[model samples]
Target: MKNLLLTFCLIISLTATAQRYSDQAYLQDRAEKFDLNEETQNIALLQIASDRNKAIKILSENGLLHPYEKKIRKDFEYRPLTDMHIVALSRYQEQFIYLTDKAVLSNAWAGKFYIDHGIQNPKGMAIGADFLTLVAGNSELRVFQNGQKIWNTSVNNLNPIALEYDKTTGHFLILTEDALYQLDLTLKTMEKVYDGSNLTAMCYYNDEIVLGTKDGIQSLNRKTFALNKSNQKLPWTEITSLKNIRGALWFGSTKGAFKLRSDGKYDYYASKRWLVDDHVVDLEKGPDDTVLVLTKEGMSKINFEPMTLAQKADYFQEIQRSRHIRYGFTTDLTLQTPGDLSTGYNHDTDNDGLWTSMYLAGELFRYAVTKSEDAKLNAYEAFEAMERLTSLPDLKGFPARSFERDGYEIGLHANGFSGEWYKKHVEENGRIWRLSDDEIWRWKSTTSSDESCGHFFVYALFAELAPDKAWRDRAIHQIKIEMDHIMDNNWYLVDWNGEPTAWGKWNPKYVNSFPTNVGDRRLNSTLILSFLQTAYHFTTDEKYKKAAEKLIRKYGYDENANRPATTIGFVEGEDLSDKWNHSDDEMYFLTMPGFVNYSFSEEQKTAHFNTVKSHWEVERSEKNPLWNYLFALSGSKNIDSEESAWWLREFPMDLIDWKVDNSHRKDLTKIEPNFRSQTYSEVLPGDERTLHLHNGAYRNNGGSDGNREYAPYIYLLPYWAGRYVDAISAPVPN
Candidate 1:
């Protein structure tokens, strides 16, 4: 009885002290978008080049020119250079030399027509201090100065494929089908420098002239004329173009473009992530230290803008507000045409509640840290969207997975019913949609326990941090009914069909049925306990507290919940244990706040904290900011702060669902496939590989055609949570 009274007093203490979050700022290095934005430029940009200072000049196929400086796109011009068909371009001093299909044209310093060379049948041209070297008619090499052909010559029966003016030697290097020739500045003296066949592109790198061939690249020393093959393995062997930008060797290949890094490995820019298509046409250094990859389809400007963590949060907030929110729910945008943002439209997804809850929770954390009015309104708007989910469904205390207008739910199940799995589970099992009592709306049913985890996460945060007392009380009330529903249904989330949803089982009978190796067994136990604890903490409801105590004391839930993540691996015959479920990791991390913060006793808190730390150890390699910040709630010093910051800094600003394929990369060290599905020894940074939401990051490569855009809540939640928990600070005064 004495122990029982002590347990009751401990529960009371949890209600009093568990809700407060400390407001302390730990300053850390901050790292941090666009409008006319990435989407617009993704469609329009064609050839891209930059000056020595990295100021960008973009040219569309139709001759529109866009000059970019700093972060702003300056004034543009339509067909600014000439009326003739422009084939190529080169920057000389402050002027641009446009090589038209028939002749040559020069643009004035500020984009007006300055002079026309009238050099007929010009194939390409290279500019020098006072003369323009024009390669014409496949064999003729001519030098034009002040709009007059000063000298002209022809190579002996050698078909020129490419031409480059060597700045160091002040001589012209002509690449032919089988040989390279050096022509003097006077356009008279010519010498056969190297005899190599199948050469495709040429560039001057320092003291050597690098030649790209069908096999690989070889550098020819200008002084000795000795050609040496590049020993480093390349991403793609068939090199198409080569450029030496700021002393770095950048090359284009049939597959993609890459830069030879100082470490000998290549920084590959492939797929839609870095280019419009993998078949690259050119490579240039872009404005603000960006990389411009011109592909067969269009051009991609990879920007490396520096920003603070707080600034990054604001940028995503703007993106979410502008594109991702649909009927108050943060959502994915379905693009009708691949890589076209104009064709994007929001549609209902399977995890609507889960996604919105994450986004809402993020806004609340933002409010808690900065107290911005916009954050409050954003949180409130999403809170209303979630409230509607509970009310739309007819079942008492049961929230719908999502809701839509009555007629808009047409072909809802039919749209997804192509396979036997959908037919058997969705069509044969039970009704998945039901019309609301108001007759104006329809709500989806069969909400999973993971959805409940998300719902409870935001609700508890709202109850704890929302400024208005009424709002906090409303959140507390929602938690009470949700908990009561689960408990009333025998520790299961009973659906509209008067049965438990396939994944909503939290009772000990169902959870313990799985072997110890399965993740669901441990995750479900923690989730239900967290739900019960949160309900009791906010509402001071004795029933919720008692139910939690019963689950722990009678069902060995404490032991089940404390199991380390390392034990979870493939169990030979178990279907659920075939691989590590990233979604389960998502559920566990989402449930962490309530699980650790609302512990009924000091001992349980310590045990749960240790469990969290153990789980974090398993996930530390991924360097997930969300998981790191969630673990920071336990007040542990080993939160992997630098890893978390690196993740935040490296995350790509372009959240477009581009088709990213890194399978052909030579740099990645492939590993034996494991239960975790980690394809490499080291995971790539966010911008280098496919960008998935909470359920991704371990895989080396996979993506869709650029047809969707993910809501930024993944970055937002972790960043704001980091700020709220004092793991990060506000912007460092610019």
Candidate 2:
């Protein structure tokens, strides 16, 4: 009766508010209503208190809701902006002006404004003690009182490149590489202060004039034009810019940037961690408790505010709500070409069964923890999507990668899928995308074994956590169907093409074919044993237990599970060792539930625990919160929960697929490529330009020629799962 009323209300609402709109039209409603991009709108939605129906209703009325279609309700909220990536940052009065080669006026209390003023007309800025702004152009010096220019003088007449104004002497110091000149406010009287070969940058600190030269940093006495005794330590000779924050001295250089504390300790922030690029061009302390770092390529903002874990959870909750919602179900979203949230989701996303199952598992954890009605409904919705997948193409247990509205196909080129994949395909949608078929729907026929692992892993979670006896029984029954299909087909997912799908092989023949030196043979053995254990626990099926025992006794699957990946390196030119696969890492650890909770014997439990621990230890340096959360389950004393919280806190506020080029960066320490590595990072996971699926993430040093956004399950699974397992403490609501 309640659902009927809600459905009736939805019908009424759609009748009243609906109109004929194109997919592009779906992309642009919120900006017209509340004036923010989708990501920013999502962040604002998350900031509202969870139970604040009034605020939620207001956002709904204002058309600030995400997906542009989700109804405004107390539980329907999420966030997108977790980053403050920028081009340049400056301050005028209380305003934080961002400069992406243009003036972008930013305010916490007001909407931002932008103009292309002096976009190229800048070389130096001289700020007076009165807080007036003076911009040095190639041929002129323009002075501004507030944000408005007051006066201009001809710098071509002065023949100076660098400019600085002195507060104590009430004079201006104009500089070129060859000479430094002292001039009055009128620029009429000029006295040469210092003779130098090259002057790079300058700033006022400690009530003295500090000039950055090719030689080193030197302080000059303005009173007599004499050099002061300057014996301060520096990391590099060529300084770009300097700022004194409170009392600690901070400076940028050709090498990197660092700070000298009062207690004589040096704090460092190099690589992509704190720098957009390592050619540090300038530094400015901006309003709103932000320190600005500008480079030749881009700008970054460092907020002084501490983010609590509850806030972090709130952030990811909304991120999952907004970007990762997936038709209120789940699928691998097309991140290569981002969805505008206007036309909604792309019709051609792959791995629906796998991705949706993981999301469903995460929702299971969420429901178990909060018992929120929303979580239950969401879990049910996803289960409906996933459980129906096995039936989508008239197959009993073979799960397709995805199904799409008839005309959509993935990876289409001028000729179609390209190479052998192109079997008479052509480009559509303005030659940008490939298209095929003419019917109601088309499902990807070729599936992989990874999908199988994902499916069973999530199924186990659902069967264990489903709220009611009916839901539990349903989950168990479905698991039985898939498990039986695999067993009947001799341990493989037979695709629609009547061939074994790639990566779906699990017979002893295939599992044992992999060389023991590589990770796959051991990995497949571990996973199949886990699957058998999961099936047996739910159905009390003796066949499942016998199968697992056969693998252990005959194929040494138990010994296989105890093998650490580090102990046996991937050999070159073999089946493995091409590269370290983070996806494989995901699959291996995701299979851990059978080891921990499926009531395994002490021997099997110890073996699986060792496998989980070895993998987790090798991955500790990555500091991925999800990995850490899963690692804690092994009951290893080496768990690093503190880093887990830090990982959540460091998630970027901006979730857009902005170009993050790390090429030509100066601060990175490069390591030699090996089978154990994709790309080495001098910084932690939080410090990278973007987070992406581990498969292709390590190909380039930092960025790809193109980009894609990712699912928040990348965040949510680890966060909520961590909370459930007590690896991390749940935060109190602020």
RMSD to true structure for each model, in Å: 6.3, 14.0
Q: What TM-score goes with each of the models?
A: 0.84, 0.68
lDDT of 1: 0.74
lDDT of 1 by residue, 1-734 (tens): 01222332343333333232222323221111122224334444435566555545655545544433212243344344436566566776635566776555554544443345454555666776565555455556677766677777765555677777767668777788788887785556888889987888888777878888887888888777797556436777788888887688988988888888787777677766666567766777665556666665555666555567777778888989998887899998878897667898887766788999999988988887789999999999998888888888867789888888887763455234546666677656655777888998888887888789999988987876788979878887888888888889998889877889878899899999988878888999999999998888877778888998888899988889999888888888889998788888889888986788688887888899889888888888998978977776644555666677778876777788777777876556889978888987876778778879987758557788888888899889988877766666556653
Q: Which stretches of candidate 2 lie over 4 Å from their true place?
A: 1-158, 165-174, 178-198, 205-285, 290-306, 331-344, 409-417, 421-439, 678-681, 694-708, 732-734
> Residue 330 error for model 2, in Å?
3.0
Query: For candidate 2, lDDT tens digit of each residue in 1-734?
Result: 01212322332333223221111101000001112333433332211111112121122212223222322222233221113222333444434333233333343225433333362445445556554555554566555554666665664544455666776777777777667877565654656778766676666677666777765677877576678855335545577766765555667776556666565544444444455445555555533544555444434445555455555556666766775655455533344443233333443455667677777777887787788787788788887766765666666766666655556555533212456444432221122221223356556655666777777887777776777868877777777887887887888888654667657888888877767767787788777887888788878889988877877898788777678878657676775656676777778777765654453586666767777777777777766666665555444434566666656665554443434443433334457776766444544334344445533334333533223445666666776766655555555433
Worst 10 residues of 2 by lDDT: 23-32
How high a TM-score does candidate 2 get? 0.68
lDDT value, residue 512 of candidate 1: 93
